[model samples]
Target: MFIFVGCAGGGTSSMFCQRIAKAINATDPNLTATFGGVNEVLADPIACIGDHDLMFAYGSIDVVRGYSAFDFGQLFDAILVAPQVKYLTVTKQKIMANYPTIVEDIPSEIFGKMNGEVAFEELRGELIMLDLLRGYQSSLQTASKNADKDIEILVLNADHRNQQLAKVFANWQRYGIRVLTETYTLEGLYQFDPPADFELRLLFGATMQLNQQDFVRISRRIDGLIVFSETPKTAFRDWRQQLDDADIPTAILDARMLEKRADVTQLSAKLTDFIQTVEFQAEATAGQIRLPKLQTKKAKKQHTLFGIISWNSTIK
Candidate 1:
């Protein structure tokens, strides 16, 4: 079987490609895995994923839409950080049914830091599970050609590798909230995926230089938007205003939030509440503007949450 993985820059996807390729080659050398960037695959799908058995694309919904135009046997958005139980169980059953030989025993010490043979075996299991889950989801949605996402959130962060931000995104996924940022890292890839009727895509503004048309396209689709900036006062005010003018739900967060899990958790909760509610009136508090608390969902949602978190950077 051929596995093709594509991400915005191809860095994260390439690493996963290499790991899965190494594991698969140990047992079945005939199987192959490859990686490419968003532009490369869109420029030439046949050259990047020719004769592919399955394809996984991780990025914004636009990236997924561009890829869905092709005729891959199975295409997965690869956005679910933590999926529901039934879907995960079905994924495992399919893998066991098809590739029982690749399965290995789990070590008793699977909870914490592991090393030596235990680490090796555990990593192997993880690769197999991820590989199978991608393919299984693709097969389930083979009939549909459209990218059916219930909610799409755009995140702008200075560092894509921020551990606190990573945990926040994972928690949001655990609660069935999908996200989008500018770019992704290996650590991010390890903790992400999307479910049917739900999706997550990352587009970090600090890394990816988005043009006017790019912003226009993205602005129309996103349900909620949050930005984490080191210098929010100077860097994000104008752009934030532009989004606010367009009536897009936008929030400007202090980059220091990336330093603590609790802060990020509070930010995530605010975003989640914003996504579910229908209206919001911005309020400022404690040198940090809270986005919006939960209003009622009975009426249509108006993208009006304009929040900003600014304070002395030295506090961090």
Candidate 2:
């Protein structure tokens, strides 16, 4: 079997892809795995058609929604239209279970002030679109009197990754790195806030250049620094010199290198646990599927999900 994995660019998807390859290989040694960014695959679906038996797409609902355009939607529609794709897997809930500390740190308000269940349903809607596409494909195939391909849509609950990541965040003093970037592309790294025990910060190159005082302030706060390969050395010369003068630990690595060293290793250890914890269920098309018809009840708001529960308000 041939499998394709896609996600938003940056290391999360790539790291997950590695773990997936290892897992799939362990189970069925004959299967082949291929990986690419979701946008790249969507942009060129023709090249992918008939080339793979399964496709796994990863990302937040926002990431998936960003790809929804007249033509782009058509591209995704084509995937289901073709008989080559036998299975499609995507997430239906937050990767990590909710924990009190995580809830307090990340703030559900960012997700439109939603309760965990509502937020999950909102995210799951994106995947429902995929289910609908598959249903449409099934209908067409049945209409033609062709043997229906048992196309399975696997909705993965990835709360374990979140739970494990919370552990990582809780122990950020050991795993956290102060990353310097030139743009907001790296903001995704901070989606989950780190614990207060570590001084986790992102310094924009231009901002530092314009405000030396702020640069100096942040530099002193950091005990170590990591710069991606794409960082302009000349622009950061003074900052690097300051780091050297302060005798701080520093390493310069390619963007991909940073992801592997900092993210993949920490996350891979949690994959087995993630796989073991995953719960799967079939879902109906978008219109037919109804959000849980329950009244939004007010209760004491506490950050708790998966296994990360906050006992106190203090993050440390």
lDDT (10s digit) by residue, model 2, range 1-316: 1112222343444444445434433443333334455555544543532333233333322343211321222233212111111121222112111111010111123233224344333423433444444344434432110121111111111222234434443454355432222222222222233333222333333222324433332322222344444553543465566555544445443344224235655453442233223111111221121221211111121333112221111100
In order, the Cα lDDT scores of the candidates are: 0.41, 0.30
TM-score per candidate: 0.34, 0.23
Residue 309 alpha-carbon offset, candidate 2, angstroms? 39
- Count clashing residue pairs per candidate: 16, 10
lDDT of 1 by residue, 171-215 (tens): 877877655554533223222244333455554554254345355
C-alpha lDDT of candidate 2 relative to the true structure: 0.30
Worst 10 residues of 1 by lDDT: 307-316
- Candidate 2 collision pairs: 95-158, 95-159, 96-162, 98-304, 98-305, 99-303, 99-304, 99-305, 100-303, 100-304
Best TM-score goes to which candidate?
1
lDDT of 1 at 277: 46
lDDT of 2 at 175: 50
